[model samples]
Target chain A: MPEHESPIVTVDIVLLTLEDEQLKVTLMERTKEPFAGRLALPGGYVHTNTDQNGDDAARRIMTTKLGFAPSHMEQLETISGPTRDPRGWSVSIVYVALISREALASHSAIPLHLYPVAALPELAFDHNKIVRRAVERLRSKGTYSTLPCHLLPARFSIPQMHHVFELVLGVPLNRTSFTRKVSEMGILELAGKEPAAGRGRTAAQYRLKEEVSFFHRPLGDGM
Target chain B: MPEHESPIVTVDIVLLTLEDEQLKVTLMERTKEPFAGRLALPGGYVHTNTDQNGDDAARRIMTTKLGFAPSHMEQLETISGPTRDPRGWSVSIVYVALISREALASHSAIPLHLYPVAALPELAFDHNKIVRRAVERLRSKGTYSTLPCHLLPARFSIPQMHHVFELVLGVPLNRTSFTRKVSEMGILELAGKEPAAGRGRTAAQYRLKEEVSFFHRPLGDGM
Candidate 1:
């Protein structure tokens, strides 16, 4: 058998963010054939020399295709189908990312549609299924994981962070309880002064403790 | 560009079972190149003619590649990388399946190795990552989903079922509580009289209630 007969696999990034409190995924219109001119996730053939590891592959895809860096990019799942590609048999590793709305507010070259997960139109390849799985991961695992932070800025207030959780989980949380629970985690530290906004006393700003490891906790154990 | 120039995606199945109280994943020694003669998970390329809907691709891949009929299979994730396949840029949809030890034991000449996931050697492409993810899924979400049933025979006792849970989760479950929780789920029905064994009263034989939708429940929320 010749060397050209082997199979190939690649990675695709599904960069998601909560813009205006709605779940949105970044998509790019195709510039090549097969699914050319159609809207799809911003990804291409996985380059060998791009990044050192799997997380870097996602970062590279996001940077090259979307022109922005994601705060957190995670391996969500993989999608493979014999006929998914018109060329031949190919498999793809799909990674889902979360970031703040302001991160990509100015990227216009790639032309992205921040569509809600529920109202997303038919996408190229098996990405629709991929997107659904990402949504499920976000909704279910978001409770316990540091995923909530992915939707907020690096330096933000408790109320702003709480709003992100409400948007993603589709559940309302008591403000007092949420504040107490988050503070006890010791994952955040006060940034000094409070934000000047509507309230009896302005809320304090916080920055995530850099050395803390959030992956050790069991999924959905507590939120 | 010609239609043949496009890339394709495929799905692979990691049919897992418990044999002699040990966890095992189904693998085949490849007769072709690209990790030829090495033990790899049973899979095949995806094509338009295999299934009308993308969701059915997993079922088709199992039947075509391994020559077995599985009752169910769920999409785990997708993997894609330029170097993962030497042929071209391809992606694969990986699915993890669970079946009873009795089913695998009763079947013969399936051309598979029941390898333990923990001691697995370097596999073809990114298969090691795929297997690891599948095992993590089983360990975490196995309780909430109908995963245990997938590892049980058509009719089995509560004790037999609990044994499987123990093997997969690596935890001992209280017999009384396990049975009580399972009964409350209303997802398993008494198939008939239990198998007679030396000792106490014969336990009732039970089978999964096919009507209950197990996927919709929250993960880590059930027994």
Candidate 2:
């Protein structure tokens, strides 16, 4: 096969976090051709020489583009088309990384541009579509599973988890029902200490026991 | 970039259907090098000039290898690694297509090899892993949505749908409760005429009302 025979392959990561109760995504300005100086998901070509697989390629891209890679990275989906990139036919193995704003602020080496995923500007290639797909997965999983719990720090209170679910689902949930739903799922464990609230009451704290726990019944039909 | 710089990209499809009351997957023996004469998922190199996208490549591979593509095709996860392929790092965009045995028999131009998903033998590349992933998705979706209805014919009876669910879930469901659960889902519309069962009894007929309907509550926790 000739050089033009294969489709251009790369890895793109959508790093999402919560800041000021708004879901934000990390992006960088491409300094190379095909979208130079334009905002895009932090990504680059797959280094076949050093990358053992897509996971390796994703981690390498994140480490190279950003200073440090987030601990939790998930394989989202692969997007390919003839026109998605200025280069010939291309395939992008996408990943979704979740982190807390506080954690990200401590690790980032470069000046990171964070944008609200709901109000993102025009991005390079089909990145905007990829970001939307990742967000859709998170939102859909928020209904019945503790997937959105990844957006929170390792230790989170039940109320904090409830608020994260509301933020991801983009709707308010009944406090009691939401707490009951989490209790029914049994995916959370009691954390060490309780956090003080405005009323001088200590809120019950919980930590996720699994990466993701799905209960048959949903908290509320978000979609 | 050199020829080897771009990873080889291909499309593989796991065509699954219900046959003899068991979940069977379609595979073909490869006739080319790098695993010639070995059983593998129906797939081939991505035709960049012709294929519009991954969907096109999957459809093309199915049509060329299996004579016809299934009516319902899902974009399963993509698999990639350097050691998985002998030549170089490769990316395979995998798909899972569901069709009834009756429909498949009518469309296949050549002899097809059908194997039970649970008893799969060694296959070329990482096809077994891909098959398991597809089955896992089906099983997970089976617990909460009308996804398994796709494995049946377009219009089927309630008992027929129940049997298909049992096959996918590998569990016998209570007859009355299963019917009630599906009815609550509101995913099935009356398919007009009833099918006569044994002993002068008639079974109610129903057809899927949506591509996929999620009722929040699952039929049962299959996983």
**What TM-score, computed on C-alpha atoms, does each candidate reach?**
0.70, 0.90
lDDT of 1 at B156: 85
Name the top lDDT candidate.
2
Q: Residues B1-223, candidate 1, lDDT per residue (tens digit)?
A: 2223334455678888877677888887788887898878877665554443334667676766666656566666555544676765545667777777676656533565788887888788677777877888788776655676778788988888888888888899889888787887678887888538767657789888877432322121241
lDDT of 2 by residue, A21-125 (tens): 999999998888888988999987887777777777888889888989877787777778788888789888888888878778888998888999989999998
Q: Report model 1's interface C-alpha RMSD after superposition on the true interface residues.
A: 9.1
lDDT of each: 0.69, 0.81
For every candidate, give the share of true A-B contacts it also has.
0.12, 0.60
